[model samples]
Target chain A: DQQVKQNSPSLSVQEGRISILNCDYTNSMFDYFLWYKKYPAEGPTFLISISSIKDKNEDGRFTVFLNKSAKHLSLHIVPSQPGDSAVYFCAARAEGDSSYKLIFGSGTRLLVRP
Target chain B: NAGVTQTPKFRILKIGQSMTLQCTQDMNHNYMYWYRQDPGMGLKLIYYSVGAGITDKGEVPNGYNVSRSTTEDFPLRLELAAPSQTSVYFCASGAVSEQYFGPGTRLTVT
Candidate 1:
């Protein structure tokens, strides 16, 4: 069973436009959500995160919005840059797990055209 | 600080062969994990260790074994390699929230 899902396999946007990536989860026990950006042949790097208690979290040009009721979350990048083109993965952490194990989505390949 | 490191960036093994993938962390993190990523798929957890001498299975642990003899090292072993085992493996370690990942090891089983 895939606890987390990213329906879109890929996305394309202009460098000066906005890019939005969406994710959904079936498990309500997840309280923390994180987004990681990965380049080809490189490890993923942390981008932004949001707690269940908050509806939105922003870090520079990146913003993540969480909707507990809909069991969904999204990552938004304003004025996307060419450097923002990469695979974006959404992960969730369940509650009461000391291991902090995360369930990750299939990931979306984002293409920002210059 | 070389947060996390994995050895043998690329390897090729024949069917029924056995090999080990090495992972190390200099962050002194108490938590470490191993994951595998297949083509067009997300990463699936293989095994994890809370600390030295402690380990647990994750979503998919079959055909694989792991050991945590020390806080800095967590190695994953494939007893009998199969074509289905071909994928990129990742090692990660962290304290609480975020996990730092290694560059990854691409393994091919023929």
Candidate 2:
């Protein structure tokens, strides 16, 4: 089962525009969520994350909003840059899971058009 | 710090061949994991280790083997190569909340 889902396979936004990527999870037991950015031939890099108790977390131009009631989370990049263009994956972790097993979504390819 | 490092950035194996994908981390973190990513698909966990000598299988573990002999190394071994195994493999280390990934190793089984 795909515990985490990113329905949108691809997205495009003009440079300097707001870019939003959404993710949903079916397992309510997950308490930690993370977003990773990946470039071709490279491993994924952690972008930002938010705990289930928090509704929102922000770091500079990147902000993550978590809506526990809906089991949905979104990553928003304001003033999106061409450098931000890459595949983004959303991952979730269950509470009290010692192994740190993460369930990742298929990923969304975001292109920041100049 | 190297954080996480993977060897043999790229490899091509023939059917029935076997090879090991090496992974090591420098952060001294106790948790390490192996994941494989296929085209148009997200990374699927193959195995993970909580510490030295403690290992467990993840979502997709068949045809793959892992051993954590030290806190820093977690290597994945593929005994028999198959075309279905062609993909990119990633090794990550860190807490469950955040993970650091290696550059990745690309393997193609012909």
Candidate 3:
């Protein structure tokens, strides 16, 4: 069973516009959520993360919002750039797990058109 | 600094063959993990180690084994490889929240 799901397989947006990617989970035990950006032929790189205590976390052009009641989270990138075109993965981790084995979504391929 | 390194970036194996995927990290992290990603599928954890000489199974540890002999090396072994085991494997290491990933190793078993 896929605890985390990214319904959209791909998304396209124009440059200088906002690009939003959505993710949902069924496991309420997950307390920490993270987003990673992956380029072709490279490993996924950590972008930003938020603890369950906080509903929003922002880092430069990227921001993530979490709705615990809905078990949903969304990643927004403002003024999307061509360089931001890549696959984005949303991951969740449960508390008290020292190993931090993250459960990841299938991923959404984001294409920022110039 | 070669944060995390995986050797044999690409490999092709035949059924019943056995091999070890090498992973080494320079961050001196106490935690390490092995994950496999199939096409269009999210990564699934195979095994993990919190420290030297300690290893535990993760979500999908059925066809894999791992050992952590030192702080820097955590190698995954596949015994009697099968076609179903073919996938891209990744190695990660970290301390708190951020995990550094290595360029995945693509293994194809025919």
Candidate closest to the true structure, highest lDDT: 2
Candidate 2 overall Cα lDDT vs. reference?
A: 0.94
DockQ-based CAPRI category assigned to the predicted complex of candidate 3: medium
| Candidate 1 chain A, run of 10 with poorest lDDT | A94-103
Segments in model 3 whose C-alpha atoms lie over 4 Å from true places: A97-99
lDDT of 3 at B48: 88
Query: Per candidate, chain B TM-score?
Result: 0.97, 0.98, 0.97
Q: TM-scores of the models, in the given order?
A: 0.97, 0.97, 0.98
List runs of model 2 lying over 4 Å from the truth.
A97-99
Q: Candidate 1's residue-wise lDDT over A1-114, tens digit each?
A: 899999999999999999999999999889899998999988777888899999999999999999999999999999899999999999998889633688889999999999
Q: What are the interface RMSDs of all the models?
A: 1.4, 1.2, 1.5
* Per-residue lDDT of candidate 2, residues B1-110 (tens digit): 67899999999999999999999999999999999999988999999988999999999899999999899999999999999999999999988778899999999999
Candidate 2 residue lDDT tens string, A1-114? 888999999999999999999999999899889999999888999999998889999999999999999999999999899999999999998877533789999999999999
| Model 3: colliding residue pairs | none
